[model samples]
Target: MWGGNDSTFLQGNTNPVSGQVYTMYHGTSMEAAKKIRKEGFRQSVAGMLGRGVYLSRDLEKARRYPLNLQAYQRVVLKVEVNVGRVKKIDKQGHPLQNIWHDHGYDTAWCPPKCGMVPSGLEEDCLCIYWLIHKSLSLAGVIICRQTKHLQGCMG
Candidate 1:
């Protein structure tokens, strides 16, 4: 069964519980970006939301990822994701925090500034069962080049 909406998860571009296709972003190292373009995404073994491909609807949030990398080494991927059957894991210690997929959710979402993320930005995790075109697909890549002014750098 699909998850129902809660007002708290409705602050972003698209409602997490809507089960609609929305534009999202994934940040990575330039090297990883190349590999992803050629080989596609792999679900993370674990994370804040756990065992899924982490993404975000917020461009700024996406730009801050692979956190250790410098701007010049980072790349943000534009993607389209069909956030089907979402489960809102808004709080830091929510029972389904890392295992929403096991509860029949295709995606797990944490809303921005909800204190779940240190950055306080929004985050989404697509379950391994819904990888690639079945739910997520690449749209484009934004390469961050460090300039004298650090213009257009997302790092």
Candidate 2:
């Protein structure tokens, strides 16, 4: 997850399925680094949800055995969802809406009339994270709650 691409990741880190892990220290501005890490975490969780299985991106030891893998996948999620937006509440645990509102339609199939979208900047956009997270959860896929702190998840 730390590496930018699959090749770099394979060169530096062991294959996760091999039940191995290594720590790599980094020296960077905390603020910037946190942003990158948060994004990576979300993407990683999305990968797991998409696969319908819980694979540890940070800890291979966690799924080293069949029993562990089974137990991990047993933890399912249950929540509501909208196609391209969240409920009245927001990811920050906010009580109301109209403040940070997400507006768009799902491009699941890149349907007609769904041309390129301009998501120019995360800081200037509403979020679709809660909707995605909730949908995944309702399907019995649980993502980390810690990801709510990510920049693109607050709305």
Best by TM-score: 1
**Tens digits of per-residue lDDT for model 1 on 1-155?**
11232212234544575567777789998788889989989898999998999988887788877889776677899777778888888797899998898888899888777889898788889986787547566777887676677657432
lDDT of 1 at 92: 77
| Weakest 10 consecutive residues of candidate 2 by summed lDDT | 117-126
The pairs that clash in candidate 1 are none
lDDT scores in order: 0.78, 0.24
Best by lDDT: 1
lDDT of 2: 0.24
For model 1, state the Cα shift of residue 136 in Å.
2.5
Over the stretch 1-155, how does candidate 2's per-residue lDDT look in tens digits?
22332211222122222112212111123342345344521322232012112222222222122233333222222122223431222123233323323233221111112221122101111134533453322212222222335411011
TM-score against truth, every candidate:
0.85, 0.19
Candidate 1 stretches greater than 4 Å from native:
1-14, 153-155
Off by over 4 Å in 2: 1-41, 45-68, 71-73, 85-155
**lDDT, residue 113, candidate 2:** 21
